[model samples]
Target: MPAATSTAEAAGPTAERAPHTGPIRWIVVGSLLTGLLLAAVLSLVVFAGAPEHVITGSALLGFAAGWALLAVLSAWMTSQPQRWAWVPTAGLAATGLGLLVVAPGDGGLTAAGWVWPPALLTMAVWIGVRIRRALAAGSGRWLLYPVVVVIAASAVGGAVETVGLASDDPGRAMPGEVYDVGSYRLHLNCTGSGGPTVVLFNGLGLTSANWARVVPGVARSARVCAYDRAGQGWSEDAPQPRDGNQAAADLHALLQRAGEEGPYVLVGHSIGGDHAMIYAARYPEQVAGMVLLDATDPYRVGGGPPSAMAVLPSLARLGVGRLPPTSYWSTLPEPAAGQVRMFNANPRGWRNVRDEIATLPALLTQARDLTTLGDMPLVVLTAAGAEDDPARLAGQERMAALSTNSSHRPADAGHGALLDEERGAASSVQAVQDVVQAVRAGTPLL
Candidate 1:
């Protein structure tokens, strides 16, 4: 009895410390979760109401389900905030699947045009509740005022950015014809009487149709043209592998079929930028100058769906690649309905991402074997991205390095600056004008 009593006395403090530790643990977990949830909610505010084509009832339903799941997860856990954070993120994934499977480009909500206000409001509400509980705990008491300011500022900034994304003017694509290049075809839209043709190569998941937002400015003086690359939009797919050389060869055939003149000004975005570099190197006489818009160097990075497909191998095997997209109101099944929502939510944008994914293998090779434009005048537009995103930030950095190495403009703009809401397209217009002036004057556009 004496020995037992002694042991009990020794264990008493440790046992007492354990229960007191509970609130501390909960506070730490809750704090981390609060920050993460706030970030996600902010991102969603910018993402949910984008200028997307898909706006289906099913997609909305899926988003609601995801939101509900996330909220439940948040409320269910009595202590750990991490549980709540994962709820929306996971649900968003499921909803994205549903969006990917839907057809008719039905994907995300575009009823309004900005990402911050509603997001800030939601975050503020969540934070207010969390803060109340957190303040009672001594650890986060000092952070109360700063947190309030952040919530209010986020709402204001988001509203401003949304206003910036929308425009009173409705842009339109110029008229043109289809140019058949051996195995595939390209839809060409050109303007101007006769000058060095400014060729626009659409990026992955893009087509000639997207240029309507920016083509008008350059059309006055230069023979500017925008075309849907083979296997995209109205263009047909090629049996030949998509490589730099093959792309150049196909382009030669396209030019011949379309009766387009030589010494064209080539402007490309993302993967198309790789193709432009190749085309200029392979056929210098046919090319005059080049413009790269937040271009992706396939040599440095992987092609197609870097996420879901190339990055996540386990999910890739499960056929995220094969899954039909979930756009707005899509007619998709179980898992697939969840994918399209995400694909549609992207800001750089994609109208037909799934079809583009199918051709990624060929473009992978095309992305390679592209370098050394030599004397070709090149202007590169670098994209500004968040610091947290290494992939995006690194890709833009590399593109800037390439442009600098090639003796071109390596300035930063929004990722989709060419289709930018305000001053975004201005950079492109200036680049084109410089190229046109150089070409017309018979001077080096380096």
Candidate 2:
């Protein structure tokens, strides 16, 4: 009976040991794998062309903290990995919801920006499930370690790159006179000297710097003025719901405050053409003539305005529109190209541009109701390609009819002809010069 009792006690200890040993083995294996994977990732990040600025002690500390936290979480995941399988999935879902609530400036996630978060979460959940199953099965466990290494490497690379990107600054210089137009400051650039000031208004998202192609030639002929619209270019942000009416009123006030007398020759391009028409109609006495360059039609604004359904409030809440400076400067001259890049990088520029696109339909409707230009000298310059589209040509012809003295000038140029080219000069600049000459001489527009 004593011998039987001794055998039973030994069997009881053996039975309890297997279950206890299994969990400890899993925890030890998971921790070791996690440590090796983290070490490999850290080595990759340190040697993988990390920027000099992000190599500081603080950055290293941050990376260490992040890695430790991730390792702990991953270790926990290996224990009952299937039980918390839904956690990462829930996090991914929450991120998507957050993005929707904080609508970004480009309206949604850009192609480059959308792939990382959800993909990482999916990989993590997959790794967790694989580890749990492998531990339970006690076979094929080593195979899953490679996945951990790969995920860790990728995650580390992305984090490092993100840190580098945030640390770099794209420096931009402001080179125009700033006018406090009540709520915000607008940047204005004016030169030359004479009456009937040539007031240049650019298309959507364009700044005073866009006049680089045309300003030099036009300034040689008359006192010309170009400006950045409110919350655009180097201008300050204003209140919400920015439309053409508010823009026009602001310009009027700007000119007054600047002591620039009118009887002005309003030169407008694209959407600016619509604003010019509105300005002329509203303040006819101040406007001496008008020039519309590849102008949008007031009757039917070619492409309908973008839908206003973009949750604008989310822009402020989410801090969404900050993008890397674009490289569109290749099409423009040196300084102008650089200026364009800087303006594109500005978050406020995107906000204002989106607002303009949203309000364009309403602005077009308002423009259609504007009174005729009467005998005001008007020059409607159509892009050479306009002849290919019968509807567009007809629209151009209708624009010329707004004034009895208006002339329809078809340029052998495409859109954006106003920008000064290094070779042959710009036909758009010449057209504006001709109009200024005609207006100054009090000659017939034809």
Most accurate candidate by TM-score = 2
User: 1-446 in candidate 1: lDDT tens per residue?
Assistant: 99999999999986765543445444444544554454344333423322122222233334334434434443454332324334444544444445445431211233322442566467667656655663344434444446556646655654543443343111222247777666456667677755888888877665565565457778877778777665554555565335557656777788888888878988888777877867766786787777778777464535443322221221121123333444341233323233223223333224235435545556655655555555556677766653556776565555445432233454456666564333666677877778777768866654
Candidate that would win on lDDT: 2
| 1-446: candidate 2 lDDT, tens digit per residue | 99999999989976755553445444545544554554345333542222111112222233333334434544464343333323433543444445435533322333223455346646666766656663544433554456566555554444443343344343345565788889787777789886668998878778777778787877776899998778677676676656778888989988988889988999888889998888887788898888888888888754243322122322221222233334433256767776775555333455566667767887787777666888778888887788889988998899889888888988776776545343323666666776777778888775
RMSD to the hidden true structure, all candidates: 13.8, 12.1
Candidate 1 regions exceeding 4 Å error are: 1-174, 239-244, 304-352, 358-365, 386-412, 444-446
Quantify all predictions' global Cα lDDT against the true fold.
0.54, 0.63
Taking all chains together, each candidate's TM-score versus the true structure is: 0.48, 0.65
Count of backbone clashes, every candidate in sequence:
36, 2
Shift of residue 161 alpha carbon in model 1, Å: 32
Question: Model 1 reaches what TM-score against the true structure?
Answer: 0.48
Off by over 4 Å in 2: 1-172, 301-330, 345-347, 420-425
Q: Report residue 360 deviation for candidate 2 (angstroms).
A: 1.0
Q: lDDT (0-100) at residue 362 of candidate 2?
A: 78
